[model samples]
Target chain A: MNEVLLPGVGLRYEFDTAEGNRIGIVARRDGRFEVVDYDRRDPDRSRLLLRLTEEEADAVAEILGAPRIAERFADLTREVPGLSAGQVEVAADSRYVDRPLGETRARTRTGASIVAIVRGEAVIASPSPVEVLRAKDVLVVIGTPDGIAGVDRIIHAP
Target chain B: MHTSVALLLELGLILTALSALGALARRFALTPVPLYLLAGLALGEGGIAPVPAADEFVEIGAAIGVVLLLLTLGLEFSLGEFAASARRHVRSAVVDLVLNATPGAVVGWLVGLSPLGVLALAGATWVSSSGIIARLLTDLGRLGNRETPAVLSVLVLEDFAMAAYLPLLTVLAAGGSWWQAGLGVLLAVGAVAVAFVASRRWGHQIGRLLSHPEPEQLMLRVLGTTLVVAGLAELVGASAAVGAFLVGLTLTGVVADRARAVLAPLRDLFAATFFLAIGFAVDVRALLPLLPAAIALAAVTAGTKVLTGAYAASLDGVGRWGRLRAGTALIPRGEFSIVILGLAAVADPTLGALVTAYVLVLAITGPVLARLVRAPLPARSGPNVRVDRR
Candidate 1:
């Protein structure tokens, strides 16, 4: 969250959930981040555009309860793989998870995978770890809503 | 009389008036070209300022605008990608064009017009405006179906004709020898053929070159190649954009699915400018006296085009709904008609005026007619193809 590409240019970091793939990302302005990678799989497929920002990403991540899914995109590859921005729901199945709050959601959560993170009209491309899970992220988790709620408390708890 | 401020003011006034009228037409679901044309007529002869010599500028300017649109459109004509399209659509496209254009031409001749004018009209209206009809069909989630092929083929044929016939008319009117016309047509075919041959012969080398290059450099080469090829076509009397289109068509087969994305932004910018230019500095007065004729002609253009579409589509198991949709799809006319008219106008001013009047109707009423024709959409090319996937 505290990274700067250049002077006075405090760039935020993020990844989007696009076509079910994790991608690296950097944001130059508020509310729009450049997709850097989709889970370290391929870089040539760059220029993945997304509409969510770090703050909005935080809100969405918290709401979805799969903050770690943002970082651990590799887990969702088979089910809800990452992609660039613009897909709403990937239609992957998921089960609920009940877990205690711990390190980053990536370090803690198990079993539950995020199928997608649908916000307003667009999907977050390929989200990544180290990217803050926002309350706005409507994480389309594989598990039930309660499982998502438990996972939410794990990463987002102060 | 030659007040400078008055001119700018008039321009703004016309755009605003036409825009407002267009909005109203949309609200009422009436065609807007008639409204735009009416606005031109009222302001031209009936109002404070007249749109003098609209006929002259719109003639060529409209053609260029359509060229821009066609240039954008050429990307869609990629044969390879559509190879994966449904068999139903392919059959439909063939049946649709032969059925529609052939009869449509005869009927146009039956109406009061010269042979060349009738030929141009038949050619212009034969295939539905693929751009318009395809878009509406896509919106309705019917672009990939049994009838989709017929609709798309007619649309594809008409679009290609727009670029080709436009220049053909120009060559004829310019008094170029039939030899030159024959030569120009030959060159056009050759250019398109060469692109395929070259791409087949060396497409991989180009793709490899693109794989590791800076995004900027890759884009530069693409643009450079497109321009160079298109320019060559213009040098030999073929449409330059048509050449670029062929290059695109050639590359589509070689490049696979990435070609469309590569050209998306470039096409979008050029397309926007092209459409906006259609609304550019057009005079209103010259059209004043021709208003009645223009109106009548617009009706003829739309009626004939719709009938052709309906007839062509009907032969392909395109049910009543498909036929109706085809009819409405053919409603919009823009660049191709303008091209034919502009070229013909050179041989005879009367033919030119008639074509111009007709295309104007197509451009304006195209959207409205689409809106009015509310039959259930035809099926898509594949069951997996999402509605509005385009």
Candidate 2:
């Protein structure tokens, strides 16, 4: 990826795809985004494909990205016979609420890994040990069915 | 409390007229600066209507307008952007200065203006309107063009140059000796360097000091601090605009963004008043006499700006059409040129008429010419292209 600084405007990021097509995205200062394709005739000139407002861009990103994340983990779990993936919700009354993720020790106790935490509209992939767990967080766990169930019990335990 | 009914009525009417003119300008996809100036001319001493009661308010508002303009301009920048631009486009900036400034100097010499007038004119011609051109690029959807970075870099450097240029002009305009002017320049440049260092090292602290959760408090803190610093700069022979710019430079990240949002409306109001004040200062009769010279100067400088823009864009390896787009994009002269004239108008009274006419001609024409440049080939409808939204 090539990042170009448009001073007093915003940043332009350009990258070439495997298909040999060059694409550019201009992220403007005012939370606007412009997606463009470089003209084959004139490599410098960009043909604007889409203009997205901040909210629209976020929506588009989520639509394209949210499913792939879960699918990848499912595919990984499918590779092993006994492995499975499950979401363990962090309930409001859970002891870990507003506390660091490390304190749970779910991975050490049940051999299940917390791959990501979904909070509201955002996904925190590969959250660090110090990441604070909040109420209603959906933790994506990967392990055997028994391990996944054990991890869920540990998270919601009184 | 006593309120002047005449002042309220005239001020309200003037604002309404400005809004109408602004809408007209927007309909044509043009900056409202020239229209504001025209309105000011019409409402000034020798025009169709005069607002005697609002005169004092307009004058004071204009001063605040310049400060706010510079402050916001400073806020728009970051040290990283400035360094990257300066590193890459130092040569382009040099070419831009030489190509654009020489014509103005030659014209000033031909007109037999004093030394200060020549310097001021040179600066007026050298700088492009970042405000107008940035908006133009966005409006035309040319922000993704290959040459945009080159164009924007040149603008960044020019605005940075003004930090030094303004103080020198201020000292000279005040009839200071060469020694004093030199000292003022050094002091201003040093201040800029210190501002950059401060922003890098203690930006968070400064941001914490100024930023507030409440928009009203943020507005008050930023405005109050900027005005106080501007006054101090004026006291020390540096330009108040430069001082406000320094205040802007010290802020970064979220603080600058929120401050900008809160201050934007106030800046617009005052900036409109500033443009109007320039028009009010110059007699319409004087502008008519200077129109021919202004047109001639505009024609020459506009060409030079094209050359400068092309040179800058060529360095970025943009194609011929892209270079042309870049060149035409740099043609408009607006707020800063008028600010330069405002600083030096006292030195040469005729400068007001000449610059106002020059800016009026170019500000209107520059954007139109830029748009006329071959429109980007319509988005190719193919597997890769998708119209996500209107």
Best by lDDT: 2
TM-score against native, each model: 0.53, 0.86
lDDT of 2 by residue, B170-275 (tens): 9999999989999999999999899999998998789879877789999999999999999999999999999999999999877898899999999999999999
lDDT of 1 by residue, A83-104 (tens): 3111112111111111211223
Candidate 2 chain B weakest ten by summed lDDT: B381-390
lDDT of 1 by residue, B156-260 (tens): 554544445545644555567667777677676666567666666775455445432244564566566667776676676776657666756555322323444
Error of 1 at B60 (Å): 11
Please state the CAPRI-style docking class of candidate 2: acceptable
Residue-wise lDDT of candidate 2 within A51-129, one digit each (tens)?
8998898678668875576788899988899988988889755767768999999899999899999895688989999
Q: Considering just chain B, what TM-score does every model have?
A: 0.66, 0.97
Candidate 2 Cα outliers beyond 4 Å, as residue runs: A70-158, B375-390
- Give residue B350's lDDT in candidate 2 (0 to 100): 76
- Model 2 has an lDDT value of 0.90
